[model samples]
Target chain A: EIVAAIETALGGGPLAGRRVLVTSGPTHEPIDPVRYIANRSSGAQGTAIAGALAGLGADVVFVTGPAEVPPPAGVQVVAVETAAQMAEAVRAALPVDAGVFAAAVADWRVASASDRKLKKTRDGIPALEFAENPDILKTVARMTEGRPGLVVGFAAETDDVVAHATAKRARKGCDWIVANDVSPATGIMGGSENAVVLITADGVEDWPRMSKAEVAQRLAARIASALGG
Target chain B: EIVAAIETALGGGPLAGRRVLVTSGPTHEPIDPVRYIANRSSGAQGTAIAGALAGLGADVVFVTGPAEVPPPAGVQVVAVETAAQMAEAVRAALPVDAGVFAAAVADWRVASASDRKLKKTRDGIPALEFAENPDILKTVARMTEGRPGLVVGFAAETDDVVAHATAKRARKGCDWIVANDVSPATGIMGGSENAVVLITADGVEDWPRMSKAEVAQRLAARIASALGG
Candidate 1:
């Protein structure tokens, strides 16, 4: 496939013989058809990642939520919207070499969905009940059968970004957690560029801000190098 | 002001006595009226940080490049485009309690710009020259007068993510470097969720993945918590 040629051109085909699965964007939690809870995620990071992985020669399966950008060519793409839908899609696409749960899936979903959009009542307000959604990262990380060799999760923090992220990695049972402060001023979410910290059991590593695409390229290379172990 | 109230409601009123400066988004390096060399960066992370800092009650000055989204409600907003323009904005805005260089400034720019878009040559090949751009984070971090109490730079990495990021923090002369693997698969760019690593002289600390908004909130809170030191 021409895709194979492109991958070889990028480098040594770092991800050669590896299978990678990635999640991207915000998973919607619907209160009603017209009203849903969603974060401001454009999915640029996710799609860029898919391209990055393919460029490294990985057989990548991208499970994406709704995104403004097109998915990268030459990868298996499964699209979904809600948190539950995303979880299912990821589950079906697994048995990969590695997994990165980068999606901002809502922590909670409406306890019940209204088939129709809820009308604005004459009363001042309306209360919608909710329940916790499945933690996809945790699920995959803890898989008993054919678990990916590496599982990474994202922990976005506004305060004590490192502290909370460290705890999260332990709680979620993932091998790594990438943390960042996404305060509105940082312009990370729903934005094109990002600044983040990578938290692993070993320690933390800081970075200078750069284009997300460049970041993807480098990460793919690193993952490929790690595959030799 | 209502903006101040929103800050309090957002759980960042601790910044009341502090002063903070933040830079967000990508700086456009213009080559012509219709075209420019610019990285893909939305102002989400930086803007979120500005909001978080403001919420903590800090007197915040937000220096931003071209961003699609509106700046958080209650902070001083300065909009610039080119990396040079961004540097100017930061110079005017600094001398704060803390400074966060969260913007994804282009590393290089066209050596010269054409007043109009250049037409394609008959041969269909054009040569464009480039030069290194200013290092804003290093400049501010190494300032002689009224230097910020805390200065942070972001490290966006893909390969040797942690090792490279740690080196960047030292090169930039910042107190801390927040590193993220932007490998296309990591999805830190243009995504709602992020994973980060924090690197200091002592060691690295990895954080968990969460919503970008939460990351901003936690980072701001930590900054405030470290106010006395």
Candidate 2:
């Protein structure tokens, strides 16, 4: 790791002159001033990937939500709370060599979010309306102008992991999709270990369960190669 | 602090031989396997209070939800995820001398929570149904048998702090209510300092803004006095 950092400092790695963008963590959609809807992602895998990319000499821009793990030391961190804010941040950090969308963003947000805390009344529970959040990965991948050279999306699926991820890659118009089973029994959502399936135009490759850092390093190397660095 | 620990070890403080129950943190109500609802409580105040009570030689059973701050040492910690589990834990630690309900428990949980992660489909947004959660403080305070000598509740209010908390005290039948303005402007919801108003049978006493640790120590001392320690 020290050697990698020294090499990056000397601008000597394969990705020396490349700039990359990574979005990580779970976006919190607020229902009220005090309460919010969140996901189980701890951002461990995303943070590790950002660190790995930076270690390989890529100037990384990490747009993150309120994650349990702190951001890596050498990346430009843009912290956000909601899907809208994350999308805005991603738009602002554009024209990179590659884009990695790893955040577990909420599909919908409470359309009727309240400024005041909702109280229980004799009338009964309040009705919560919902609205769709921005599809950040698809927006970036389908961009016609100034799009990243390679766009990689992530799919956290409970069932039909490969099929879901493969479909996601096509639907989002991304170059690659890193798929994982995040079922509670799998313990991959917040755990240190991950087992991922890489889905590309060519085919699928299932990687064995390993530490998040190892998965990140392997993925970063693949990205470096794909970017022709 | 070391003297306090030594005194507690020697059973020399005023609260020696007393058994206290303290509930802290924010309860997470799951909406699905990957998504859930949470609040902004960091649990700093509640953790400090538990530590202060233990410092005074009390035997403390700390019932906590998912909190940012860890449980204090010298107390038996019972960790829980949701309000229902927290209520069950509180019920199990019964017959104590006093009970401090400091947890920012969710009043409502998604009754329509799915076992599987909800996907975005052509069906538009999924409708969410809510149900009232167990009122832990009120349930314990209104207990007919095996009731603690004193029951204390907390209110995090955005407006009319004293009036709301005073009404809560009457409604819940708790002995006292520790009320605070948690409006975002005050920065008290997740910040270190607090300005609170204590509502009792006598009247409302507004405490000046102070560090959370100081507030905890003062409240612990008050509890000791109320219990005739």
What's the residue-level lDDT of B142 in candidate 1? 88
Interface RMSD of 2: 1.0
Docking class of 1: incorrect
Q: Can you list each candidate's DockQ?
A: 0.01, 0.78
Tell how far residue B5 is off in model 1, in angstroms. 7.0
Scored on chain A only, each candidate's TM-score is: 0.92, 0.97
* lDDT tens digits by residue: candidate 2, B24-69: 9999999888899998799999999999998998999999999999
Q: State model 1's lDDT.
A: 0.76
lDDT of each residue in A1-229, candidate 1, tens digit only = 3665665677447687788999988776665433454544678877887788887778889988867778899899898988999989988887888888877776667689664434334452245565778889999988888888888788766667788889889988998887767665778765778787887777988767777887676666656666661
lDDT of 1 at B83: 91
| Alpha carbon deviation, residue B149, candidate 1 (Å) | 0.8
Model 1 chain A poorest ten-residue lDDT run: A116-125
Q: What is the interface RMSD of each candidate, in Å?
A: 23.1, 1.0
* Candidate 1 chain B: 10-residue stretch with minimal lDDT: B116-125
